[model samples]
Target: MAVQASPQTLAPFLIEPRFVPRVWGFDDLRPWFDWSRFEKGREAGDPLGEVWLTGDDCHIATGPYSGKILADVIAQEPRAILGPVAPRVESPLLIKVIFAREKLSVQVHPDDKLAQKYGDPRGKTECWYALDSQPDAQVAAGLKPGVTMDQVRAGIQNGTLEDSLNVLPVERGDMIFVDAGTVHAIWPGSILLETQQNCALTYRMYDYGRPRELHIEKSLEATRLTTRAGKVLPVSRPDRTILVDVEYFRVERLPVRSQRSSASLAASDEPGPGLSYLFAAAGSARLTGEGFEPIEIPARGLVCVPAVGSAFVLEDLGGLDLVRMSPRWPAAI
Candidate 1:
């Protein structure tokens, strides 16, 4: 199945989000989602923990592509939608809002080599940019320095694995990188915007005695005593703040000042063509471009600007705190 985009169809648009139910989720998403717009709330089923912005099954919410699945759209016209320079045809990144009421599983993810060996597409290397955090909120990023794999296995068996983790305090607007092979867990108290490679291969080592299945052997094999997982410092610019730029993706914080005129796309000066994801983390804004109608993004809404589309400008509708994320391919590729 294939769909072609006419001139009228090539415009920045919105994609409906997919909600995932989790035991560690909250009953009321509140500011993130209005229950009135959803099917049902706590009365119907489990609490909602994650709202996936770019899931494969998510549908295009606006323009000529409306009602089409994201994966199918990209598969049909990868270069037109994802940019001619995109590393792969399919979507390269998965963006999600992670809400945790309880701790997540103490787990590790494989790298590209190990993932391919296990018949998976790729590995998971993700970053977290805090949207909100409670006082004293912290996350277990990696193992304590010099903690060997033998000790990690012993701790898991003894139900003392948490003690071996190096817990780091997290605050709002902080960015942390969690590369592959990092033993990590997200505890209660923060809402995180997670950007990662489009892969989900988790090997759980411990789960606080939960009855769920464990992958001790594979986890130990994928674990690293010391990992490149910790807080990330931002590189500030006059117009925006570069949150994190890795081989997978680059995210920046664009603060919309109360201006009389629209502002040009932040990356308009860069060479080559690419796509941009505008995430309204705090307030609403408007996206305008040539050959298309103005698209308005509500608070917490997400919109995609394709490379083949016309040059775009952003206008402040309210106090807009926008985060722009774009994919980054390896230089070797």
Candidate 2:
């Protein structure tokens, strides 16, 4: 994980995929990536909920960084691997491909203030980018207008809590932001790319007759009763477009065509020191820089690119569509 390289010498590298099972999950994942390669311990009928693209424990899959975990890379070469924007040596963002076959639990996350009070480092604020969806697929975001905590408690007791939620229909390419304190749930048949804070602290309020533990009091304390509206409508752009920009992270959608040369992908001027994550949603590409060999990234693959004074480019792109994620300081915004 530790590489004795300067920031300018760093190259983009791929991470191993981690498949996670859940009760409300899909048996097959399609149109995003093939799930056949990941059926070792899981049976054909077992539900697979998530594919974690990058994490502290995820192994580097390519280049000299191969066989190293992300956490070790950060610890050994914090600045050269993470650049100037990283808040700490550790990665600040977590990315996942979520497939929901059934409704997720009605849950809420505490804000940073509440999280610190509970002895955690930070709270969770996440955004979902819809990759594919079945008909009638929707998400319960926030609470209904004029709804009160008393009413929410009553509905939960009577099993009518969903009626008090603001359900929003979803389709391909739609972006939905879920801030901390917003009560939310992902409905069935939705495949989404979720980007969020590294923390996994969720306070569940209800779970639709499942025998899961309920954090009723904690959820009530975290929930913001006002109408939960966090959808981000992206504007039309030719090359790159900002999807969501929050204090935790900024996400951008970038398109590349085979017609464009590698030089076209690079900035007109050299980029300053920074680190960014790239996810290839469609097609394939090769990441190239001055110091390393071109790293081929398959469709639906993820890459972490760290730049010092120079920038990296997506060469040999065959109509690739990418999602770029970068961390941001809350104080700057």
Candidate 3:
């Protein structure tokens, strides 16, 4: 199969913000959803609202595209994005724009080896895109300078774990890349877009002194304890584009520019041989492929194209910015 953009379709999605609980109440959407609530809470000023633009919240779609479950889809198409069939299902990536109403638990993810060693079904490697931030919004990226693994483990047990983690304040548009084994957390009052491998393995180090359950022994085994080192700072080219790399995904940001936009189709910009999913993050753009409709993906709307066919043209229809994501190598993934 070739890489091509076919008309995209939408799967069902839940208003995933944590505070208010309603599986997916349309009435509660205004307050429950964070970034792009239509009337109440925070408005996601874009056309597709926040959910549709980044279908990370969308649950299930079609063959090999699994939502809420990774094993099943990978079983159907191992090479689709999770990689060549061999062991268990490996989702190439997972995406989510987190609205942290409260601090997230300090956590670490295992790599493939550790996951298998612990008899875990999957591991995690992910990144973040800051869409909104509060004055005190911060992320625990790495360990504090000069902290050692032995010190980290002891700190967790002693209740001083926060002191051992690197706390970095974040602003809107900031990007952070997290490889496996990195101890990290997204603080409350921030909205972020997260991209990671389709795995659910997370070892919570601490949950804010709150009596939340702790994944202690497993976390101990999963924690890398290596001093936080070599964390990358967010960088945008002279063109204001940012690229962040996680173990499973490579994501790029293109600020909406002209009424007309053009770029060569590159796998590095996407994830696998599968077609890229384009969402009008902040603007209105029309995508015209060789044989498809000149479909318009408004801000908050999404479109998925298969990895085949010729390059298409994207035209920004004023007051619009867009985010386009695909595999770095569609065939190889």
Candidate 4:
């Protein structure tokens, strides 16, 4: 008999399309050649990367959660989830699959204070994991070599800022770290996973003449005028063991060939609460928790474990890439 999967609170996945017309459109973004196929100015939806799996409202792209929303289920038990379930009912992390057909806008994200000031629902801090990429695919990261913040501001004023930005080529399996206030944009011909705080507010510094109007003034105010400390380095080869660790959350890439169970990351006695978001990028997996139904997550789908009692196991049907994200970090701001 097949091994019975464990039972746990399983929630649906969400995908919100950011369709824009222009030089930055996925059509233009497609030259990055990160995905498998495209049909002239159009991309498929069922498997779009930027689609969010388990977010608030659970409506953008709903599913059979099989129980209450993660936030609600967590109320009965804290350890059931991996991180602190906040009063706001928002998951600390916003996970996405990003398929770039063209370069995204040159943009900067705001910190919490500025986010609230600007009426943004969440602060944006994100990281990228390249699933595929074309030979010439590249990403715009930080400033060009030797360019200073003052020089950047001057370029903005003189319309020569593009020259001051650093562009780097990328390939499949590459990882990029993007912090709030970091000047960056995704280049075309690349497919990747983006894990970030649960915020959608973006301040674009440049749009390359897309039909959408640029947010220059807001971008100017939100952007960190001072150049960031380090060079815009890309993590070409990340140890799947530790992919990206930030103040908000942690994203790890785990591949399972057979069946694997989740190792306990924290003990119940641990002080604060936690939550976990499991994504099946490839292949199917079964999720079992203490007080919920055993959920079957198909390839490219995701499930949220709201109140995980003790720990849960991920039984891989065969070959698969799993993205496990959690908010175990204390809020810095």
* lDDT top scorer: 1
Instruction: Report how far off residue 141 is in candidate 3 (Å).
Output: 1.0
Q: Write the per-residue lDDT of candidate 1 for residues 1-333, one digit (tens) a residue.
A: 222343223577797777778777888788777645744223566788888888888788887788888898787767677776665778878999999998888999988878888898788889999999999789999999888888898999998999999998889999999989999999998999999888978999999867778999999888888888999999887777889988778889976776322335555545566777789898788776676677878888888777666566777887788888887765432
Cα lDDT of model 2 by residue, 1-333, tens digit: 322344545667888777777889877776665767653325667788988888777788877878888889777767777665555667778899898878899999998888998898888889999877888889988998899999998987888899999989998888999999998999986789999988889998889888889999989898898633567988545666778877787788876655343333333322344667788877788876676777788888998875442345675467687887867655421
Best by TM-score: 1
- The residue-level lDDT of candidate 2 at 42 comes to 52
Worst 10 residues of 3 by lDDT: 16-25
The model with the greater lDDT, 3 or 4, is 4
Q: Looking at model 1, which ten-residue stretch has the lowest summed lDDT?
A: 1-10
Clash count in backbone of candidate 3: 30
User: lDDT for each of the candidates?
Assistant: 0.81, 0.77, 0.55, 0.59
**lDDT string, candidate 3, 1-333, tens digits:** 332222233221112222222111222223324433333223233222123233233433222243433334334434433232222333345555555555678888887778888786556767777767788888888776688877777878897888888888878777777777888877765666676666668888887677667887777676665533333565666443545654445566666455433344343444334434554546566666554446655455555543333346767787665555543322222
lDDT of 3 at 132: 70
Q: Estimate each model's TM-score.
A: 0.92, 0.89, 0.69, 0.73
* Superposed model 4: Cα runs more than 4 Å off: 1-49, 59-88, 157-159, 225-240, 255-257, 264-273, 288-293, 310-312
Error of 2 at 20 (Å): 0.8
Cα RMSD, each candidate: 3.1, 3.6, 7.2, 7.4
